[model samples]
Target: MGIKRTVLIDEPFPDLFCGLCQGEFWEIDFIPVLVPHFVFLLLLLLEILDDPVQVRCPEDHMFCSSCIGNYLQQSRTCPHCLTDLDPSLFQPSKFVQRQIGRLRVRCPYHEAGCTWQGILSDSHPNEDR
Candidate 1:
């Protein structure tokens, strides 16, 4: 019952990763191979922001919504700056979401022979394979 959404892309921007969990806001599958005369690097699958949120701290640290929420429940402070945290002050990161949506991704079942691939924004959770 977890978020199984996934996508394939080349190296992603470093900032897209959450500062708290050190996770890419999504599950990811990275594949790289080297043959005798060729280098084969398969597209990597990454989970695109599962409810991404941004801290109001001056550093503007970002984290997966669930990760921060759980952390704040125990200690009310920014993970990066230790600034006092107010869960109500957390804001959704539309900019980050848009950026992540721009990434191209293959079906989570690609390795199992599913050939579907497209822009993240255009993908539907209930897509018919």
Candidate 2:
């Protein structure tokens, strides 16, 4: 048997990728040249995303819970203004959260016979969810 070399990745990377959501979907800031026609529309759509929670850093900037969590887990500072962060400052944006919980998105495993289509509050993945 051949020995397998261990590869250590010390950089941050996305934890999951689902082909169902266009795993490499278009990001507003990094739009491709082939998608210029829908640039403005995509930008507007991104600006209108109703993420439920707002994590307020010491700089008073607004961020989604996921964003803040990712940042804090790496360092205890704000990524934008470089201000120190206190996780306790996070607050629930009730209305937006409610709206988000009401929007129905297809399951990431839709191709695998999952007919469970509904709003996702915490985005947890399980066989029955």
* Candidate that scores best on TM-score: 1
* lDDT at position 119, candidate 1: 66
Per-residue lDDT of candidate 1, residues 25-71 (tens digit): 45465444221221111122223345678878887777778767878
* Native-referenced Cα lDDT, model 1: 0.59
lDDT of 2 by residue, 1-129 (tens): 100111111111121111111123322222122321211111111322223234476434444555456556788776656777778877756654454344334455555665554443434354353
Give the local distance difference test score of model 2.
0.37
How many backbone collisions does model 2 have?
0
What TM-score would you give candidate 2 relative to the actual structure? 0.38
**Which ten-residue region of model 1 has the weakest summed lDDT?**
35-44
Badly placed stretches (over 4 Å) of model 1 are 1-5, 21-47, 124-129
Tell me the TM-score of model 1.
0.66
